[model samples]
Target: MIYKTDMKRWLDLVLSIIGLLLFLPIILIIMILIKLDSQGPVYFKQRRIGKNKKEFYILKFRTMRIDTPHDIPTNLLLNPDKYITRVGRFLRKSSLDEFPQIINILKGEMSIVGPRPALWNQYDLLEERDKYGANEVTPGLTGWAQINGRDELPIDVKAKLDGEYVKNISFAFDFKVFFFTIAKVLTSNGVKEGRSHSKSL
Candidate 1:
């Protein structure tokens, strides 16, 4: 099947390039900060499911210590607040840790707006993704889920919103989310527990 790339893809390319340009300094600074805070690689790379069920390595700034626990959320029901470092908390609250994902966007593995990708280890959530059409589009750095309820919403609900976004994606909708994302970041509104700061899903 010849899948049509949405017009939003071009927008994604443009915005991601711009994001990289604007945030390059921020990225560098975060790298230095992370190295100073912990004795691990500055960037954390992990496998994530993308469009058509393809796998891609998602990039994030390392926020935890070298000895940080690796249990996927489902496997361990403990609170993430305990494992996160002091620097990690600030990086997460400011969302500076997510800046590395711009590289993923530049590489065509992600979008500036779409469903947030689920980790490959999230088998249960990944299996349910099909029900919400989550695999139909490239995962994003931010999306309806992040703006609406963020970490507060359940995975199933987030998937449903993702599906809705897939069905209704457009240039206008993308702009809406893009601007809303800026507002949310500025106000730090609706960022909930157990999700935003790497909580167990």
Candidate 2:
């Protein structure tokens, strides 16, 4: 597991630095557009469960209105689109909102590929991930589950896919996830506004 223990961190650091440098202009433009399209902070920080079930703040461009309910998953929100700002919709569809997570990767709080971090209040997801030991690894900006189904998948299925990633983690697997993720983002596939199910603890 040298890759997990040693190489992964270094890779995340180097790639994140490169990604930030490459995306700087786009990031600044998004920041300005977010500010102009909404009356809230340019960035949104949410507490999420990271490796070993520890808590860390995950950063994204603020894609929702200031009045949106805090700490609740968009899937659980009623008429979630109502809370999304004009520019936010494009950011979500383009996956540009996730660009700030390079900072988390830089901070060693996240990886470039792994299981997506669960919201701090997503108890169902947290517990489900425990069965697969998915919580043992660093959470990611884009992951296996993300490329597979993203918000469209149910919690159990998503956790299982995450577990699959944990069981088969490697450079090869990560490369596949990373490549497919770009495809998913390009097509804006599997993105959903809200789920019909009620939240369960």
Candidate 3:
């Protein structure tokens, strides 16, 4: 509980600072590529539900066309690929698009490891997370549910995995999720282009 109540925020601040410093060059490169591949801004900001169900804007490298629908889950969007820029596809696949969220972590709006934030419009997912107290902790750049299934898991199942993380929160567990997330990103595992069904979003 000490990890969750006290040390986690400090850890997030230190790690996010280190990560941003380390990835500065790559971040610049990604920004350039995004500009070349799309006509919009270099970053995309979306409102997301964070700790204690508060809302915050989560930042990521812009990966979609400027005209794409706002506040909609990609899986629920019609012809999602049609709206994704070329570099966006690679960013999504490689999970590099998430690098900008180090800013969020640094800002204390998120953590390095916790439940992934739900989109503001993802009412069902938010309600489900509330059931298990998953919304009590700060959301993360990558999380237990993210490593377990990423975009492929159903809403309830994903929330359950997140709850499991809340139950077992610790440094060891966080490291495990972080390490496996790297492997998942490398293999592009548990990533799906879109879902066939909606979850009441």
Each prediction's Cα RMSD?
A: 3.0, 2.6, 2.4
Across 44-142, the per-residue lDDT of candidate 1 in tens digits comes to: 887888888899899888777666556365224256676666788887777777888888998999998888888887777677779977887888888
Per-residue alpha-carbon lDDT of candidate 3 for residues 8-74, written as tens digits (9 for 90 to 100): 8998898888888999999999999999887989999999999998999999888889999899888
Per-residue alpha-carbon lDDT of candidate 2 for residues 22-139, written as tens digits (9 for 90 to 100): 9899999999999888798999999999999999999999998999999988877878778988999888878888899998999899999989998898899999999999999999
Q: Residue 90 in model 3: shift from native, Å?
A: 1.0
The clash numbers for all candidates, in the given order, read 0, 0, 0
Model 1 Cα RMSD, 1 decimal: 3.0
Candidate 1 matches the true fold with a TM-score of: 0.87
Q: State the displacement of the C-alpha of residue 136, model 1, in Å, after optimal TM-score superposition.
A: 1.7
